[model samples]
Target chain A: MAGPKYVLEVENVHRIYESAAGYTHAIRGVTLRVPRGEFLCIMGPSGSGKSTLMNILGGLDRPTAGVYKLEGVSTSELDDDELAELRARRLGFVFQRYNLLPRATVLRNVMMPLIYTNVPVAERELRAYKALRVVGLPEEYYDHRSNELSGGQMQRVAIARALVNDPALILADEPTGALDSATSELVMELFAKLSEQGKTIVVITHDPDTSSWGDRTVHIRDGRLFTEEEERALIEAAMRSGADINARRGHT
Target chain B: MRPGDLAQETWSALSANKGRSALTILGIVIGIGAVITMTSIIGGISNSMAGMFGANAARVLTINLHGISNFTLDDVAELAKNIPDVEYTMPKAQIQHEATYEKTKVQATIHGEVNKVFEAHGYKLLQGSGFTEEDEKRGSREIILDQYSVRNLFGNTDAAVVGKSLKIGNDEYMIIGVADKVNTFSMTQYDSQSIEGIVPITTAITRLTGNPNITSIEAMTSATSDADAVAAQTKEYLSRRYKLQDSKEEGATRTVSVESNKQLMQQVTSMTSSFQAIMVTVSGISLLVGGIGIMNMMLTNVTERIREIGLRKALGAKRFDITSQFILESICLCLTGGFIGVVLGLLGSFALCGIVGAGLAAAVTGSADPVLPVIDPGAILNAVLTCVITGLIFGWYPARRAAKLDPVESLNHQ
Candidate 1:
């Protein structure tokens, strides 16, 4: 809530997975808010419920309890198709593995969201081309299979895919997890540039270096948000453990 | 999603595994093909059989007499007068006798018939005149040699043969007519030296085999007459004519039994219908098997593409989108198979028609000609509809299962 207006607000959300083996409480209670044009990093260890929160935020899943309001609309009140429409029109997602369709070209991968819209056929390629250009992907890469690109380039295509629908909010789960530091830095810089263009971004990651690139970091521990002091302590401890990461990457 | 795009993607996914999809279609093809071939052949044969038997047998009721009965020519006349639906009656008698035409000698079965026999029965007078009513009553010595008889006795069916004389059992008679190409004549079996002829009943007994008995009487029903009604009236008339009283106290049995060809024809038709019903049921099982094959393949696809399903769902695909995609693919596969089966079945029926035609030609006239298949549009429509239903029924489960899959789990699937 540090920017001009709040784009997303969650109140005490919880998620549970039930199976024949047992019921798993993947998320307990977590409350959060993201203002428009703000870069928010959600930092957590493995099994710390950050991914569950990301999934709920991306509307890939519904929360078991509490409110998820996107742009003041109570998302929990919407049906599955409405939520899907919300995701298609208002939200975009990027995954850690750069989940580009393996056999599809870069432009086609970027144009996936447009398929759900009533946009004219002739306009889809133009929009996808503009998105790819914004992500600094060369024209040659537009026709090449997205999966065949280098880790950084593939992540770039994933970013272009997220931006193609002109979504107000982008949720990226570990956007730089598989890349070397330099490539990760480049991808993070792209996210920084998109935020400058007034796109609200939420990047989920375990790396403090990645979190530091955001405007503010929100740390999750045991399925709950840490206090400001606790977040600062965790970030400082993580920095101590992997010292001089930002300096090593020549980031200010 | 755009309908066109959805279909294109669905088709692309199905065609990706070319070999498996082809095999699934082949199963449907074989099933539909079997149904088509079976129905076509059954219809063709049934039609031909109905044409042969239904045409004559349904209208003509023949009553065979046992000699102990008192039923006579007067009874035949009484039935015509008394029974409201009895259109007419013709009494028939036949006897085998030796005949000679100059140096030629032959055995001939002589049919003693009235003038109505030529028209009532399917007897075509190929060459000469049929008997007049006066000729029948006067017991004229006019004789009608069938073409086979002319060929055997006169060596040909020449116009002069009609005027020539043939001696039957030492009684000389002039042949006044030559006739053939009738159902009765054609159905008669004759050795090379044997022949058949027809004469007026009044003359036949003395000149032919000395048979004074009419073996049977045929009754033609009015066009509007219910066959069962006519048969019952005829039977009642015969029982009364033979003096069989209903003495229940003495338990007197019937003196003569009455039979109707119409009843026998009804039994035959029922039997044919039952056979066709059984064939249709069997064809249904084949299509079911084809449907099961599609279900099996679709289930495999659902299981294999769990991750793809997740990806699609995450990409904002609603459950209906997922369901329709899979169902459309199944329909495409099954309909393709059905079309192929239809083509194969038609081709197969034509081939079978060729084989059956040759066999029939040999049986009928010893010359082969191709018999065309009688295509039943109802059966084809039934088959095509079955294909669509099979697709919908079988494809539904896997598609629903796919649609219900959790996006998070599927996206994480390897």
Candidate 2:
């Protein structure tokens, strides 16, 4: 099959952070491309610049240098308002912390992005419920406040919020970072199901265990792509070994 | 943002922080209450004074002349007959004497007048009969006691003293009747005097001090409208008759000067207005302080809700939308406070009137008690508008700061 059309194109992007000590280079001339409906993951140790690249791609921050295009629109050339509009229209984000408004109900949290959109209130609420339903949360949990929910529940709520807007790209930064091993597995399964529904999902994480959930893995070290082939091969092998073990145990 | 949405949001937020919102509103209530109470009290006093003057039918030009050395009773009668607008003139020989009625000695003033004086001047008798033309022809020594003195000396009976003889010093005079409450001209100046008695001019002069000379001349006019002009004209006439020269304007400043009640009324009005102004000013300070409190609270609220602002921006809210939400919240707060304040102020003013025993009058001038808070509706409207504008003034800067916050940085903040 031919490679899918590129939904996102990044060329020689650099990100610099200013601190009291001095300026720190987070991303160094990173170049990458993401195809439509591809489930991709970036994995590395701490300070790998994976999250930095995810931030730039999500329009949460502008890159210090170079250009990136989202759906043929150059992000580098857009003004702040235009960039915000682009993010609202095309990008959805899920953070490790969930970043849900503590005062808002789960349904209201999900409906937040739709508030900025031209969608009617009833339609926005319906779409939010549908997204939550897709993530396996009960309809009754819609009224539950964010702080009242468990770690896994909160992440699911965040996922529902991200999907409610029906954006083209989903950028999740360490989405399972706060969950336990079992809860992390549940969240990863939700991401996998979203990907199966033709979503272009990019997850950035430092955990190799979490990276195993993605269809393809790209490893980064010191702000550069270290070994894409080796990372994908390793993830594929781990999945195969798990399938073999489950089959031997007679599990479906 | 829609107004309905903003209102709902503001209400919800205020409810969430009930204590803070109540405290902020309390400031405004007290401020408005103070203004209303002060103005009402001052207005009440002025109204009472006006009522007193109105009841007496006193004109600004009506002045009582005392100690006219050369003017006789015949001269006073001649002037009344000659003057153009002068309705009636009476040579009043007023004397304070102790009278014994059933052994209770009461101090009284005997005012002497002829029959024509009572007819032209507007004097109403409450009980018994007034002196007739025959009594004037006979020069009868008969007295009229006021209702207050009658109650003090003869108890609550409405029985007439018309035939009873009352001893005054060595001479005894027959009591003709009881007069109604005398509208004393200078009672406001002297609270101790009772304004208690009246008798015919001949009786007062003959039965009391036996002084044939009249002390003062009391005159009333035919028309109330041109009473002041009549007074000025009378003063000119008196200045020529008394051979007095004008002290200031090269005309005549007569010893028998004619004055109007309008000057006294104006003085009372100005005094009341200044008092009201001072009180309103003090209340204004309170309102100013209350506005400051609102501003301080709104600022704190903005700082506390920075994360919520960031979330709103990320969700697609524009800067104006965020600013509008907060400014609306502030106005709503102040309006709530102002409403309570007006109600409390009105109640407070009523309570003050009750306490002072000066029944409620029109809060404004000219009209009677129709519109409550009798002053300008503009005063209350201006107060409400002031609060609303204050909210906008105080709430704008904080709202702008909130709208300008970077979503990424704010979200990253713990």
Candidate 3:
């Protein structure tokens, strides 16, 4: 039998953070989906719960209610180790900070995912080199430590790591958040290129310019998702009341 | 993760903080080194004592006669003949007196025994022939000097010391032989320059003390017989012969006292074992502290690498993978320390034995063999196993902490 048409399926997923103080709803019944090979972007300011939704999509977290399916497997049914296996084999995560082991070499960083998946040593290096080539990293810098690389090079190495496992979904959360405008453009172009090569890419970001590179963009506000028209009307209504949308966008 | 990859990661992680790792290893080194040193030294001493006591000594028993009790040569021979286990018997008397040869004068303990005492006591004759039965019967005024008295009286333990006349309490006696020194303990070697001579018991009683009584009768049991049982039988025989009762009072004059070398050997063995136990206990405390130090360093390593752990988790590392890596790092540290410790501990044992041997030789003014440390293979194996166990026990909590870290929270940690 063929697999599900969508690589990622989210159905009314909700995430709640419980603390000693009270229960705060981080994701209020959000639903979304991305078909195979689609470039999807989720846009929101810092407090819009996009990070929570991204965590759930990457299988780094599980929803408090509802189901999230990645590569046709429901995440809620899996234990921690099974979820880890699901992530290793099905989903790739690219974080805002790159999250490379700073002292490890570039090739070793890219091969990190394969290490968890019990890949053979010989094939690990070959796949790492292949991923690095796809991300356009030079062979000369393969042995250089990740910390010694520039921001854009580090992000590219991170992308190479994410792609090393050939995952079904590449979930990148603010991959260019630490880069300059020029490096951001290059990184977004690389993602667009990867998207066009039949890779399912879901990039979560706040900047509209970054979201413009994706085939579709969804805006999340106060733990709720909205289409472009609905977000614009909501922003227009917010501006009439003299609420600072720019200040909220700059909320870091 | 693959074992190879996990090992590589552990190695790199530890090597990243070389200084901290080295300092932590030092604690275990000192602990294991102290334990090995103490056990080896004690082991050497125990071996020496076993050599001294487990040979002819284990088959010998002594019966002391006091307060008008006496044993003639015939009586001793008759006792040996009557007892089934008795191999031989020798009677002895001791007299402490000043002896002189030419200008040399020294205080000497002169033992008066039968001719077979030399063989029974394991003293090797170094110079001349021992006294004959004829000499013993006739009270022939002949003497045999041990190495200590030979050197003191004639300036050497050479053959020339024999056939010399040595004065004892205004009576001159011919020196018939020179024997090697009797065994002495390492602890008392530095204090006593033992001067000893042997003569016939008949001569000692008639010439020196002017007393017609034997002080002690020594008996040897056959090798296959129990020395303790023979000792008890000998005591019973003596009590019947003297018509004496087993005294309950602290200082009874009419009671017979029977002592066996086997009992003495047991006492010495137990003493050494207790000392080893105490020393091991003290070293165990150090090991505890060292284990705590390892735990502290591992906890800090977990804290410092929290984000790295989270990243590995996000990359699909299982809890077992993370835990094993940290535990392996700790085991590596302790095993390295323990290896170096074993080596240094052996060297330390050798040096201590050398000093003790030299001190004994200096006090006796002669050569003494050094105690050879008995390094038990079992002990070393146990040390290594202890190191691995220490690593496992101390590394557990921190590794569990690393494994239990929430991936999302750890990733977001600043």
Error of 1 at B31 (Å): 1.9
RMSD of each: 6.0, 8.4, 4.1
User: Model 3 off-target regions past 4 Å?
Assistant: A232-252, B51-54, B66-70, B81-84, B114-142, B156-160, B169-177, B183-194, B200-215, B222-224, B237-244, B249-255, B355-374
Tens digit per residue, CA lDDT, model 2, A143-238: 988889999999999999889888888889899899899999999998999999999899999998888888888787667664567545555665
Evaluation by lDDT, superior candidate among 1 and 2: 1
Q: Write the per-residue lDDT of candidate 1 for residues A1-252, one digit (tens) a residue.
A: 442378999999889889999998887778888989999999988988898999999888888998988888788889888888888888888899887777677877888888877566779899999999999989988889876799999999989989988887999999999999999999999999999988899999999899988988887766777755766665576587785532322221
- State the lDDT of candidate 2 residue by residue for B93-168, as single tens digits: 7777777766667666666777554344334577887888677656677777666556666664376556888777
Give the candidate number with the greatest DockQ: 3
Which ranking of candidates, highest lDDT first?
A: 3, 1, 2
**Clash numbers, per candidate:** 0, 13, 0
lDDT of 1 by residue, B247-286 (tens): 3436565444456767776776687678778877787788
> For all candidates listed, what's the TM-score of chain B alone?
0.78, 0.73, 0.85
lDDT string, candidate 3, B1-414, tens digits: 888897899889988998999899887888888888888878877766655543587788988877754666777788889898988888888898987778767676787888877666666788888888899899989988777566665555564877779888989989888776443332222223446778888898889888877758888899999999999998898889877677776777777788888888788789989999999889888888989999999999999899999999999998999999999998988888789888887788777777785553343323344566778777788789989999999999999999999999889888
TM-score: the better of candidates 1 and 2: 1
lDDT of 3 by residue, A1-252 (tens): 147899988999999999999999999888888999999999999999999998899888999999998877999999999999988888788999999999899999999999989999999999999999999989999999999999999999999999999999999999989999999999999999999898999999999999999999999987888787777876786688677754443332
